[model samples]
Target: MTPIARTRARAVETLSLDATATRNALSSALVSGLADALTDCGKDPEVRAVVLTHTGTTFCAGADLRDPPAPEALVDLLRQIIELPKPVIARVTGHVRAGGLGLLAACDLAAASREATFAFTEVRIGVAPAVISLCVVPRTDPRALARYYLTGERLDPAEAVRLGLLTTTAEDVDEALSPILDGLRRSSPQALAETKRLLTAKVLETFDRDAADLTALSARLFSSAQAREGMTAFLERRDAAWVV
Candidate 1:
């Protein structure tokens, strides 16, 4: 099956991350598939809004260590979500970690189930949340991000909302999204696009200013000895040497 599955209802299109075996990790293939899907949705006049969701217990586990997408590709994917003419909403019902938080941050609106959890696990993996910070830093509370980014502490959905990582959280995420989706469907496409453009201006500026630097930092760190050890330890189900 394809990593991404698309479905449409009314004026909204949903793109589900269907790579359950990888917990929808951002493999090169998954990144390409999603980018292509978003392009199609953007060109479709009927797609007033897009919902990005996942199909497993984990929404996304971050970069696919074994088959990771290029840092540039990941950056492009995140920017694509932010720059899409239609509003991109995230519908998460499970764990999201590391680079996965990038996807959430890039979205125009995000609603997660009460059971959902999030973390910036990059620090633990001997890298930083470099590229994702383009959108994340602009949207979230700086203080809150400092704590989570450094410590990789788990955040509940409500905390995620409070920190601005999520627009809302509910016991029933789909129920919570109903009104928002309906509102989008009723809104004029041009108005929606202009409104989204207004909202994402700062985010896009961040991408333009820092994306190159961050992408380079990501590539550098991922190739470092520390990252190699961290990734090896993670794959071996053991602690990295630096773990104390």
Candidate 2:
């Protein structure tokens, strides 16, 4: 399969981020491919819901900064997911970081495996979760987001659920998700679409209002001297300059 591909089962569309090589980082191609796939699913009458998932152990590791980071695309992708007429469910069975957290926040519902872990790791690399904050800030616990975003603290599943980042956590992802899917299947597609618009209106407003400024904030941080040192140290497997 391609880096991002869509398949269907029982009126549900599964959008799989299949690039395990980079821990399914949001490369430009992968992000665009996913947006396009979601658009296609929205237009298909047979697709009642969407399941956003990954094929490997790490659901997503965040931006692929090997190239100059273009965070505008990630902002757009999160907007797309949040505003999509069909309900999107994040099925996280592994680790998620940085921008990946935005994807979960934008989804209408999300479930993670008990073994899955998460972190807002951008601060450690000297950037903030500026762009993703449009979605995450609203869905996340203020105290939790404040602590984790600043400290880059990793949260286990229960903490994640308590932090309002996940709907449920279980050892069995399929079991955790079965009821949601069944309920989604029982709903009328039109009602689901309209309800999604109602649910997401404020988040979409947040995106439209704050995206450009946040993108600029993220871009500036990525290009900063501190971020340069931090990223370089991370790549070299050494402590960052500020680690003292």
What TM-score do all the candidates reach, one by one?
0.99, 0.97
* Residues 1-244 of candidate 2: C-alpha lDDT, one tens digit per residue: 4688678899999999988988898887788888889889878999999999998899989887774337888887888888888899999999999989988998999999988999998988899999989999888789877999999989998999999999999999889899999999999999999999988888888988999899999989998999999889878989898997
lDDT of 2 at 126: 91
Worst 10 residues of 1 by lDDT: 1-10
Write model 1 residue lDDT over 1-244, tens digit each, in one string.
5799989899889999999998999999999999999999999998899999999899999999999999999999999999999999999999999989999999999999999999999988799999899989999999988999999999999999999999999999999999999999889999999999999999899998999999999999999999999999989999999988
Q: How far does residue 179 in candidate 1 sit from its true spot (Å)?
A: 0.5
What's the true lDDT of residue 161 in model 1? 94
lDDT (Cα) of model 2: 0.89
Residue 188 lDDT, candidate 2, scale 0-100 = 97
Least lDDT summed over 10 consecutive residues: which range in candidate 2? 64-73
